[model samples]
Target chain A: MESTADSRVPVLNGRRARNKHDKHQRIFEAASALFTGQGYSSVTTQMVAERADVGTGTLFRYASSKAELLLMVMNEQMRLTTRLGVAESTDAASPNDAIMALLQPQIHLSLAFPENTAVYQREILFGTEQGRYRTEALARISELEDAVGNILARFAQTHRIRKDIDLNGAARTVFSTLHMELIRVSLGRQDPQTLTATLASHIDVLLLGILDPE
Target chain B: MESTADSRVPVLNGRRARNKHDKHQRIFEAASALFTGQGYSSVTTQMVAERADVGTGTLFRYASSKAELLLMVMNEQMRLTTRLGVAESTDAASPNDAIMALLQPQIHLSLAFPENTAVYQREILFGTEQGRYRTEALARISELEDAVGNILARFAQTHRIRKDIDLNGAARTVFSTLHMELIRVSLGRQDPQTLTATLASHIDVLLLGILDPE
Candidate 1:
């Protein structure tokens, strides 16, 4: 009887895990639709719960507040964008091209939802310390930086990257430069194409120095 | 009689102008003290008005909200810092040295008041668009960028900066990079000396590129 009871535990645990995942997906979908439909400020948690078919308490359990929910959605979107961008850049001919390919998707995503992007930027830059989603956002950012670092590592193998270059530091600077460009784009100061060109120029300056090589 | 009336008008206008200047200074000093003593969020406009010895209405007239008041204090502080930094950098031996000299003072200022620096960074990057102080902040940033551009211009006259370089673009990039360094400092991720050194390295990469000259 003890052996039979122990064997049944896995089935129950698997069902519970699946239910939790389904509920999480439903909440994310509902929140995304509601947030994108009405502005983030106008939407309420109760409405999200109602649409998600979960108890308001369950929604709170998943996300402490509306801001956290927004961050969760953003994190998911960014992960998808990174996936697509990395896949697209696999065939990039050079390090600069790979860096651009990685960053271009993010710019396009920001352009697609400028309002959300602005809030995301503020949250990442200013809200990270106090927000519950800080860990998640930081993790995503580090992952993005790692992706850029990987490209540079690959480039370093074939080309002469500076001997004194700090790989992590260099990757971070590239990531930061891309972030600055996105901020410019979010501000309507640069369109996607203009940002791409400007970013390419900045990367050139980073790799080639502004002094004449001759 | 016409000459006497004209003389009286000038005297009245002079008194009014002097009063206005005095009140503005008092408010700035009061807000700065209060904010530095007890973080920004805890301090109120009412408290600021009382401390400054101005009416609450007058406080609002001078600064639309707490955010704007914080920005006003920051703008004043930054101007003073910039003046001192520029003065200190006057005899810098090279273009890079001058840029670092100009930036080091800012790092010192931020370290002196990390709390206020955090608020100022948020205000400048995320708060500018929505705040009443937007124009003032943008003008100040543009002025600083122009200062950097002027340095590059003077350097270019004697040195061989790449012909393809855009002086304004280069200046903006340098300004943006400094902004990034400060944000890291504000986050407690970097110390003043480390930030200064990293900024110098970043500037070297910007000016000389990461590739070998030989």
Candidate 2:
């Protein structure tokens, strides 16, 4: 009789876990669909919950805030882009080329959904240190920077990158430069192609240095 | 008869003008006090109006939104710092030094009011182009970028800077790098001094560059 009861409890627990996972997936898909190439300011969490067929309160369990909801969507993009970017970086022609390789896909990701990218970046840049999603977002950013650091370190070993510069510090600044340029895209000041070209030139300037060789 | 009617209208008009000016000043002062080093999300326009001793409805006439109110305060700060920064840049020893001189005060201005700066930047960075104040804010930013371009042009004329690079493009990229790093300060990852030092070093890296003397 105890064995029968225990077996019934595990079946109930399994169903609960599956239900929770399905709900999470629905919320995530809803956010991703709502956020894709849309003005983030216009997309309400209530709408996301409605789209997901979940109650608004239940949506809060998945993402505490709209910023977090965007994070939930963006963080996965971050992970995939970082993996793809790192892979591209490995076989590049030079240190500068490698760094560009690592960052190009990121640039594409950011530019693809300019609205969502701006909000996602705004949250990371200005959002306070709170909530689980922000922590995860920061972790993804950290992982990307570490990938940059590792790339720089590899180049430094081959004397392709300057050894005197701190690898991690340089990584942060390099990415900071890229991140800012990416944010500049949504300003409507420049066309995407012009902005991308200017950013490429800026990256080239960074590699070549602005000072004339003495 | 016409002179007497004109006299009455002028008296009323003068009082209206003075009332509007006084209320604007009050709202500005209230916002400055409320926003200084304070979490922007916590401060309400209602509180600002109350502190200014004006009705909340009246406050809307002065600033269309809280972001605009922050812009009103920060735009003044931006103008003052740019003037002082430009003066300092003229006496700097090198191109990099000149750029740093130009940006150092802007950095301090940003770091001094981390919360306000973040919001101000967020508005300018991501805010929709719909309001009068944001338009003014963008003009101020354009003026600042032009200043950077002017400085870069000066350095280029002396043959100290590379002539091949687009000064305006480089200036834009340079300031973008600084702005992003300034945003980084509010993340609670590093102290102000550490951040400043690292930023200075990053500027150095951008100047001296990463590739060995080619």
Candidate 3:
């Protein structure tokens, strides 16, 4: 009887673990779809629980409130984005190429998941909760800026960029250009192909002006 | 007695006119403050009227609803912007110079009225009734794009820009870069002088890459 009971305990534990994982994922997907499709302000926890087909109490087990759910969704998004971004850097030789590679996946993702992008963009601009989340969002933007700056700095040493130029500012400019283009595309103002081509052309312009003196 | 009646009529009419004008100005100022300091949805017409020390009926006379108030504010802003923008082109020599001149004043105004810029940015991004204002907003952006295109076309003909490059795409890129930079500055992310200098430097870079072989 003891041996049988011990064997059942492992089975029960495995089932509980799987159930917990499934519940968390259901809550996340429910929150993401609702928050992205409608404005975040309009979404509620009860609605999320109903959509996820989970009890309201079960929903609370995963996320304390709507804001916490949003944070969790964003956290999952960041993890995926970070992983994809790092993967893009693996084979890149120069910092410029690496940064371009990093941005390409993001651009594709932004296009593919425009609703998600919209939600996050608004969150970055208007959401008031400070501390860790704000820091994370700022860090992502800064990392991209630094990636561009690193390339420009190295290029400048060889006289590729203007010697007196502020590398950080230039990097920020590059990032800002890309960010705006993505927004414009999402807003239906510009075509995706044109946005991509313009981005490439602009980068070339920057490179030509910054390249080593002949 | 007839002369006394005539004098009274003019005095009453003058007072009524002054009261109406005062009410309108009060509503406008109150709405601007609330919209800037708080997100749009959070601000109520009652709050605005109270803040302005006016009756709710008085607020309705100036703006039918909060949405209308936003439209009115934006219209006034764009009118002022257009005046400043148009003035800059009058003394400019070339189309390129004209565009650069035109954008400068608008950029300066954005820096001065950061809150105004923020309100417009949010409205453009998420307002549901945006259809009512889309035409005018897009017309302004298109006008800027056209101005830039004309300059690039002329410059290309003179071998000032790359003869083979797509003028349309290049024009769009230029406008996008400038617009994004202005927003960044208004959001307090970039300093005015740095933005101004960076724009000039980037424009030079762009011209070099596109200009015909000299």
Candidate 4:
């Protein structure tokens, strides 16, 4: 009886964990589709729940609000993107280039769904959403920041970057450019090339001073 | 009879313009008070109109929406602040210092009314208000950018800055730092001292580069 009960408990726990993860994945897909296709505001939680084949109660249990729902979807993509960023930048020829490569995926993410991304950016930056998803997303963003800092630290080890410069602050500067360019691009008033050029130049300024070459 | 009609035309025209200007000032004060005291979302156009003692129709005539009302208040302050930026930055010794001085008042403005400023910034940067006030605000922002550009150009004249550098782009980089810091400050999650330190370092990176100064 003890052996049978122990075996059942492990199997039940594994199955339950898998079930929850699968449902979360469906919710992510459903939310992404609705938000990308119909935009963030027009889509309702009820719609996402139905599309995900989950009850509204189930959806709320996962994400307390639509903002949380949005964060959940973006946060998952960001995990993949952060990994992709590290891979892409690991072999960059210079610190500046490495940082650029690290951020290329993110800049494209903004360009891909500029509208929804703008709302996500707003919430993450200034929206008062207090959901755990936001907390996870914040942690995910910090992971990306750490990834950039890691690249910089690697360069500093090679004496390419200043050892004393705040790697974390510098990482923020890189993403600050990304955020500004992302917001500007979302206006649909500026070309996306401007985003790359401006970011490149900002990175250039950060690494190589604008002071006249003595 | 001709003389009487001509004299009355100047007096009557002067009185009408004065009345319109007076009402517009009243509207500005009323909107600023409501937006500041009660916050942007809580206050309605009707409340502003009533406070200003103007008809709601008249308020609508001046500002089509609440966003426009917010923009109107900010734009007026920005006009005065631009002049202050110039005066404050004119005598700075370095391009970076000059740039920082130019942006100080603007930063204070952001800090003082961060919540309203955050909304105003989100709208200006990404919101699709498309009102004349937004247009004016964009123009005003451009003027500030131009002011920063002009400061960089002034420094370049003495060969302190690289003449080859795009002053406009550099000005943009400066403001990009400001925008990011302002948003961070608005989150009220970071120390304001951190804002100055980050911006100063960003300016240092821009002016002095981050490579080991070998």
Which prediction has the highest TM-score against the true structure? Answer: 2
| Candidate closest to the true structure, highest lDDT | 4
Clashes of 1: 2
Give the residue spans of candidate 1 off by over 4 A: A1-26, A42-59, A129-132, A210-214, B1-26, B49-58, B128-132, B159-163, B210-214
lDDT of 2: 0.76
> What TM-score does candidate 1 get on C-alpha atoms?
0.83
| Span of 10 residues, lowest total lDDT, candidate 1 chain B | B205-214
Comparing chain B with the reference, what is the TM-score for each candidate?
A: 0.79, 0.82, 0.67, 0.82
lDDT of 2 by residue, B46-107 (tens): 89999999998899888888899989888888889888988998888876688778778888
How much lDDT does each candidate structure score? 0.77, 0.76, 0.69, 0.80
Each candidate's fnat, listed in order, reads 0.48, 0.65, 0.42, 0.81
Q: For residue A181, give model 4's deviation from the true position in Å.
A: 0.6
Q: Write the per-residue lDDT of candidate 3 for residues A99-158, one digit (tens) a residue.
A: 677678678767876655655665566454564555576677677667677776776776
Greater-DockQ candidate between 1 and 4: 4
Per-residue C-alpha lDDT of model 1 across residues B1-214, encoded as one tens digit per residue: 8877867645535888899889989999999899989988789889999999999999988887788888887777778888887897789998789888877777788888877787787777766346656567777777777877888788778666676677787677776667777787787767766677676767777767523344
Candidates' TM-scores? 0.83, 0.86, 0.72, 0.82
Q: Model 1: per-residue lDDT, tens digit, A134-177?
A: 56877878887898888877866766656667767767777666
After the best TM-score superposition of candidate 2, give how far the Cα of residue A118 lies from its true spot, in angstroms: 1.1
| Candidate 1 chain A, run of 10 with poorest lDDT | A205-214
**Chain A vs native chain A, TM-score per candidate:** 0.79, 0.82, 0.68, 0.80
Tens-digit per-residue lDDT, A100-139, candidate 2: 7887887888888887887788888888748788899888
